[model samples]
Target: MLLPRPLLTLAALVAALAAPSVMAIPGAVVTTPQVRAELVAHAPEGLGPGRPMALGLLIRHQPGWHTYWKNPGDSGLPTTFAWTLPEGASAGDIRWPTPRRLPVGPLMNFGYDGTLLLPVPLTVAEGFKGERLDVTLHAEWLVCKEVCIPESGDFALSLPREQATAGQAEAFAAAEAAKPVPATGAQARARIDGQAVVVEVKGLPADWQGAALDVLPATAGALRNAAVPQASWSGAVWTARLEIDPQHTESPPALDLVLVRDGVPAGLEINAPVSGSWPAPADAATPAEPAATPAAPPADTSLGLALALAFGGGLLLNLMPCVFPVLSLKVLGFAAHAHDRAKLLAGGLAYTAGVVVSFVALAGLLLALRAGGEQLGWGFQLQQPGVVAALAALFTLIGLNLAGVFEFGSVLPSSWAAARARHPLVDSLLTGVLAVAVASPCTAPFMGASLGVAVTLPAPQALTIFAALGLGMAAPYLLASAWPRLAGALPRPGVWMAHFKVLMAFPMFATVVWLVWVLGQQAGIDGAAALLALLVALAFAAWAFGSRSLGVRARTGFGLLSLALFGATLAWALPAWREAPPAATAAAAETGWQPWSAERVAQALAEGKPVFVDFTAAWCVTCQVNKRTTLAREEVLAEFRARGVVLLRADWTRRDAAITAELARLGRSGVPVYALYAPGGGAPRVLSEILSPAEVRAMLAELPAVAAPA
Candidate 1:
């Protein structure tokens, strides 16, 4: 059979070309901005009917970022997997590894950094007779460092019907070793001891008895993640006292506890029976460790208390600058209907209905989004540039209407005008809607606490609280309308009323100005300028359509020209609205404050400097007021300089998940949140929603003096 080398090679090449095509792969890889994901599979034995296989989603994170675990502590979402398997195949849940404690600002969370593998066991039906196993995986995870980003990937893998030991054996082994095992020799139990849950385990291995152990609640929402528990060994039994999470209202029949010891690769898992029931909602403990976690208003706050607070907050919102403009418009409506009792009563009821219904709708949407793992809160709509732009345009039109630049009835088609006149209360209803839209950005005094609690409660209870807020807001007008004497005291509708209506238009213009500024903060100067141009074009269109002096043909031509101009401007401006704003150099320079990040704060603290963080948004009137009156004061700035304090502003004008998480950690869902972190590793002192110069001075005084270079 011996032959020349060239002849042999030619024969081999011809044979290879004649071979059948076969597609076999160990797995697939997919990449995103923050993670590299791989769908890897391994079968020690040959793939056959009813044979079990190990499949895993291997996630390799970029440096400084991490994804959440199955039970993401405090404020994060766990990774999820959706599989597409061959017919008659099934998969088990992911075998999660022991997660590390991640400290975010003042909060503690449990997650994996670097690389992690979520392994799942899969099995095919015994009757299967396929030549190969085809599978697909859809994976989603929230990756976070300074900010959180939701990322996902899809992958497919085809495995031939043979022994597939060729895949990542070492990776699979490591993941298997990382999974927690049952504590075979140990018996554990838990009981409520005042504000803490006391967990005790007996018959642990002698070597593990005296070692320092890291405890994690396998059951989510059972124990406070941020609260550090006290652990000790009493004789042969290990005991730990953990703070109970307020959300955990009922006593669990069994507690899934995970215990990790240093120098160990895997943890010990225990299903411990609970002895005592959780305390009543009103008796839940308020967090005492200011350094560990900001005192969160209890999530289990009584329904009546939460409702009352929401109502009070809504009533107080009427005084906030954000709601003042819309209330003024309502005033104009009140004066016009002062003489008609029946009409006033109907209008008030309609307005109340609008506000309540709108609030419930909004609450439902927020809850749904949150359940789907969105990091959002109250006033979330203003975070969208499109919403802000739309609001600005809407306000501009309202202002024009009030200023007599256009009459609704005269400008609209005859049928439309007739319908509006016949149902005049519709205007009142819409005005109520407008009031809520404007008022959303402002978190009134009691409102902050109530809303913070509402977001954590059940949907029905949360919606009820929101409804109470709406009713309170509509109460003032409701009262005035019901009491005919108050309306009787008003001057009759005349030239003076017209003058007042025109004057009230100024506030609407002011609101438009604010919205444009807020848009600038989110989308920068270019976007704001484009919006102004669009607004000018729109105003022109409105005027052309409303002009009575021009002949029909002339008016029609002018209107068409204006409409074309507006359409052109809108096309150019929309892209600008989506564009990210430039770096906030000007604001930082003006205020002598830097932008906030967890690393920056840690670095400042490491260098023995106090850090003050201002969690705020441009649309929040309360935040703007505090910025002007307290944060911008010369004395406060001088104090900051004197103490070597680092100032950081977390602008929440746009949607930022990191800031949202931080606010959640601070027991707040919306901002104007101020926290002053002193050097030397102590808890930060959180300031009130409304800050005063004296309070700022006093808080600044708490900073320890830094010694001069020795």
Candidate 2:
């Protein structure tokens, strides 16, 4: 095809003017090296009846210039698509992919820089009239590199009415796959912390371990989008501190964030719900007080009955695995002076005092933290990686000392060691401390109600109950010493005592292993590894410091050097452990046990399914005991299945505010709070702390049967 010579110069003149433009029917296509704007039809199988069809709003931008997300941070306008679809067809929401943060001066913008497909689901109503569907899209966008320029164009596409072959569907499928799927385990909370708005999100995807949560509000002006978000992790929860836009007159109805896990380009994107306490802005003219926290549930049993339960629970605790390791220390104390009654009396008194003092201290701290806005309960200390690390080290040292790895050489002054050798009182006191610390995580039978009541009671009454618990715990050992016949029944203190102590050290070592695992759960594998390294360093320090062969001055020098190394290790480790991005929490997919959330619980209740919630913590020995013995057993699970029960494991291993709030609602404040929701909306049946498989089965079997969810 050759142009006439006369017209060729005319075309040349047109080319010289500027780049030529391409045109289409009922629409226009604008293309340049910097951007390409087009409307593409994604109807592979035409439109399904009463289903949504895909339509891609394709825009390709240059490296520097980019289009904006829904809430285009600051100083830019989002690309808009106004569509006129054929009769019986309408557009749904635009599904946006994860956004990038673009900076221009002091402003932060969220958008895409390269190719982006703003996909919309076009809902086609049933009984449509048209054979071929025609759509006209009027598009407008402000693309910016530094200076901003607004662009607009019209696009038209004809969608076929019938399903086509595979290639016709591939583009839409690819586009859909690239978008974020709905997020699971969704929870969010907002509050004012100083000048910033702090929003915390819990339970995204377990697979999104170490993922970054970048949130863009659905509302245009709810946030100062240009302000950078300061993110931090609290266990598996992600929190962002953002600068609130003072100019925005209203807060967002809800925090709807386009959650994007960093580096994950698959189905990890989601629009999820945020449910928790969202406090009003802190700078209100008349400051509003925070909502009052719910008190612990009222005591169902009489005070005398609760005390009896406490005593019985305390007695049974001696048999719990949590207390078994600690009892070894008491056994050592009992053996140290089996034949001498006066020293034994002094030892018992000191041990009892230690137990009572520890309980009082722990109760005070729990109350203080609760009052100070910390969502915490028993075993809360173990939830801290630092605390877990320290406890692990302590246990390891004790185990090593028992194993005769070293003596209390230069580390303890010679005079102090000499004094300890005579008294045996310090050993007894420490033994009691160990007992209570270990016991904190165990909610033996009657302990639950007593402790539950103690939390809500007046301070003095709570303290009295705690004191009673301490005395109960100390009773077995105290009674044995006070009654000479029980003490005398002990084997004669001799060579066997050495062997027994070494055997007991293994339990201490085992406890260390468990604590280290808990650290991994609280922090991450890296944190656990760091702690293990610290323990190794501590062992080396102890081995060097306890060297009797090294003289006092040399030992002292080695000790000081080791101490410096220890300090450095802690200083380097703790912050990193605290600051590292949280890994995905474990879910029991094999058993169909979902992570606990108030939303899930409410949903299950609304669905008319009987829900069983086990409020547990990783550090709670009693909770673990229940899990192994009853909750996870096949018999109990079958019963649950038969009864249409939804088993929800509310792990309070970390400080979860939702779980805490739920616990408060249940009138309890700790793990091992088992509640079974009625089929519909009804009061939940709070079960006993100590549950047997038979008991669980019996309880479920007793409920009036109903059809389970399909």
Candidate 3:
């Protein structure tokens, strides 16, 4: 026996109701009607003939529950309604009344908590005077208290033509006209400040509170979403922080501010203008500074202080974690040639020259990038996968060599080695290049500031600064070689020298490990694995090439095979590595946190929740140390949970454009940037790069006191 059509439809509806509905509104938990208004359709009781029938969305809410307006502040979905009307009848968009700002905790939600009327205007076609009008509506809305719940209802209303009235139509139309026109008269402004572009807005309403205002950048990827706009009020003026996209080199034509106040849209526009001067070309002579602060300093007292500092800094770099491994080999060389001051000095000078030359080259590259309107900074080279891959390969080779897999003792061309062996000057120049390569990782304390100025200054000034850094890096070697007596005071070479060589190998191996890790960050696990395989193959080839019994042709073939593998690895790995998605570096299991994204942060903030952002990188030792020692502690996790803080980690292991832009906005170019936001009013407090238990406690303590439990 077949079921009737209506019965079948009812059965289908029952099945559909049995399954959970997929909601467009996220995080909503409870939804109920606040108020319900009845409408009699097609009735001429209130309106004249030929007028469209109307209905009122009588919205009623459970006490303390609320639904959203068109512009859901910070994070709620706007109420939407779809109508199914009979033929020759049409309904206009929902007419929203002005909404109120509701602060739940730290977040500001745009909505209404009590009963309200949302008038929907319906039109009937001319010459159609119906006795009865039928209308259906599918209404979806988000209702919230602490958490939000989405709800929808299918509603139908019927009215007799005799009951329809014009007064009712006029009343609904008038209510809609009174709904606030999207707030206008506001505008945005932006300016370039070094690496960051600072954007500000003006003409916001004077009576506005923090919970009532929100600013959204119109351009995708032009601004970092994690950046919290710092809001300040001075009399009638409003100022807020807007960090520009650090990756943006050219000035954007215009900035669109999607400002919302209490669920109402306040559209604003601002134009960005280019202002800063460009660096001089590499070949150009350095320009003179103003007489007030002359480039040429007072000559008598410390003629070469900058150069000496650079050289000293370079020498100290041999002790830096990154440079120590490479420096150990040079130390061995020094021990071997301890008796020959000429050879030591010659090699030292050559190394110094190499360091200077490389620095000059780096400066030139920076200048070139600036001239082309590319925004770049120190460590920018490392951002390139090709550069990172090459470094990885170099470190791997060095590690293998140190492990006694092969000898680079004769790796240099015989002609060049012979010349260097005969001329100390040549040896020193080559040593300088080695020194610079080893020192690449340790951009010591004063280095960043100097480099920043160099990249922005004229050619001569930049070169001079570069020379100073190179000189500092090479100074220790130069100093040892310069004073033979001091060198002689060093312990005599013996079997201990062999032990020292092996010990030195560890540093090179350590460097290899660091490089591999960096590669993993840049290329993902797959890319890292491929590169590692290439290194192992190269090690095998070196072993084969060095075998005394192997025929020349066979050895040559093995070497060529290794080269091919390395080349193939480079070709396949570079682009894939560059495009790898960033993974969270911080151990979030302890904090029950996830990697941060703009959308997630925005959503959380919109819902009136406090947020904590941890910006960290895998390669940064300090960041790791802090994570393990302080941040990951159970006590800290408990505190975060107790406070209801939304934990977000912005990982910067690789060159993440979003992370970089965020850093730039915070007046920083490197991790770790820790920020804590209060519920609504207080400005966020930025934690120190090197976090401590006490510091974290102090910062957390500083947060505005949470309301006492009821």
Model 2 off-target regions past 4 Å? Answer: 1-301, 418-423, 549-572, 579-583, 702-710
How good is model 2 by TM-score? 0.57
Model 2: per-residue Cα lDDT over 286-380, one tens digit each: 10111123334444544556567666766777787767888888888788788788888888888888888888889889988887867677667
lDDT of 1 by residue, 195-221 (tens): 688899998888888899989887886
Off by over 4 Å in 3: 1-318, 367-371, 409-413, 416-441, 444-471, 560-590, 597-612, 639-646, 673-688, 705-710
Q: What is the C-alpha lDDT of each candidate?
A: 0.79, 0.69, 0.58
After superposition of all CA atoms, the RMSD between model 3 and the true structure is: 17.9
RMSD of each: 9.8, 22.4, 17.9
Better of 1 and 2 by TM-score: 1
The positional error of residue 702 in candidate 2, measured at the CA in angstroms, is 4.8
Q: How many residue pairs clash in all the candidates, one count each? A: 1, 3, 50
Model 2, position 184: C-alpha lDDT score: 66
Each model's TM-score, in the order given?
0.66, 0.57, 0.53
Query: What does candidate 3's lDDT look like per residue over 263-350, in tens digits?
Result: 3433333343434432221221111100011133333323345445455555565566766665665677788878888878777777
Best by lDDT: 1
